[model samples]
Target: MGDYVLLAISCILVNNILLAQYLGCCPFLGTSKKMETAIGMGMAVIFVLVMAGAITWLLEAYLLKPFGLEYLRTIAFIIVIASLVQFVEMFLRKSIPALYKGLGIFLPLITTNCAVMGVCLININEEYTFVQSLVTSFSYATGFGLALVLFAGVRERVLLARVPKPLQDTSIGLVVAGMLALAFFAFKGMA
Candidate 1:
């Protein structure tokens, strides 16, 4: 239990997929413009990531390894992630139409987000047990949510502030994101 808790914390604040390794920057910068959209994307991503992690781990353990077809891990993982993304999309479109519309392309983009595949690969590579894989993936998604929401809040302020025309939008966003990444790294030692 303690190990799982520590792994979760590490994946979240310290080894964050966005702020730490710089994965999923597309959604981080794109969907993060609005707090509501960012939160929705975060939640959707969390669900997909956790599901993909578990499914991939099971596939790797039960089929790939047993059949000596480990080379197909990437393909298998992609299928699982894509399936989860489709499910999330349909569910959100049905239940939360507004947020679903707000998310737009960003939600589908989660299907290709390397972070989801990366965490699953990491779980298989590290040979994390079922519970550990789930916890780690959940934490990574939580970290993503944390960064997205916080960045959205800050970006709301950035939008209001007057700035030179050259750095009006994404240019300033990139700078702020870099700084946020650095700020997150400051906690590396604690984990």
Candidate 2:
């Protein structure tokens, strides 16, 4: 139990997929303009990352390793991740049209989000047990959500602040992201 707690903390704060590792910046920047959209994207990522991690782990453990098919790992992981994204897309479109519309291109972009692929690969490469992989997956996704929400809050506030013309839009966003990354660095020793 204590080990699990430490792993969770390490993943969520010390080694955050977004803030620390810089894995999925595309959706991090694109969907972070509004708090609502950011929250929506965060939740969506959490769901997708967790499931992908579990399924990929199983695929690698039960199938790939047994048959010595390790070379196909990348292609297999891509197919699994893409299929899961498609499922989420269809479910959202049918069940929550508004959010589906809100997410727009960013939702599909989750398929390509490095954070998802990175976590899955990390789980396998680290040779974590099934439960450890699941925990790491959830923690990483939670960290991603936390960072996205925090950044969204900051970005929303920045909208009202007067800024130099040269440092507007993405320029200011990148600057703010750097500052946020520095803040997350404070958690490094906790792990």
Candidate 3:
């Protein structure tokens, strides 16, 4: 339990996927212009990441390893992630139209998010047990959510602040992200 808690905290604040490793910058910068959209994207990503990790772990342990098909891990994992995202989108559209409407596009976008696939690959490479993989997946998702929401909040403020002509949009956003990354670096000793 203590180890799990520590791993969760470390992943969320110290080794964040977005801030620390710079993974998923596309969604971090592109979808975070609005708080609502950021939150929706974060939640959807969390769901997809955990599901992808679990499914990929099982496939690697059962199908890939047994058949000596480790060479196809990347392709297999990607197919599983894409198919899972599609299935989730369809399920939500039919059962929860409100959520589907809110996250419909983001659901599909998650297929290529990189962060989801990255977590699965990390778990496989690290040889984490099933429970450890689950915990790490949740932690990675939490970090992704934190980064998304934090950037959304910063972007909201950036909209109001007066800025130079050249750095009004993406340039300023990059600077702000750099600062946030520095701040997250302060948590290096947390684990």
Return the top candidate by lDDT: 2
Candidate 1 vs 2: which has more lDDT: 2
lDDT tens string, model 1, 1-191? Answer: 88888898899998999988878888888998999999998898898998888888889989999899988888888988888898999998999899889999988899888788888888988889999999999999999999999999999999889989999789999999988988998989795
What candidate 2 gets wrong by more than 4 Å, as runs, is: none
What is the lDDT for 110 in model 3? 87
**Number of clashing pairs, model 3?**
0
- Best of the candidates, TM-score: 2
For 3-97, candidate 3 gives per-residue lDDT tens digits of 98988887788899999987888778878888887897898888889988899999999999999999999899999999988987887788878
Per-prediction count of colliding residue pairs?
A: 0, 0, 0
In model 3, how large is the Cα lDDT of residue 34? 85
Q: Write the per-residue lDDT of candidate 2 for residues 1-191, one digit (tens) a residue.
A: 99999999999999989988989999999999999899999999999999999999999999999999999999999999999999999999999999999999999999999999999999999999999999999999999999999999999999999989999989999999999999999998665
What C-alpha lDDT does candidate 1 achieve relative to the native structure?
Answer: 0.90
Ranking by TM-score: 2, 1, 3
Better of 1 and 2 by TM-score: 2
Could you tell me which residue pairs clash in candidate 2?
none
- Displacement of residue 80 (Cα, Å) in model 2 is 0.2
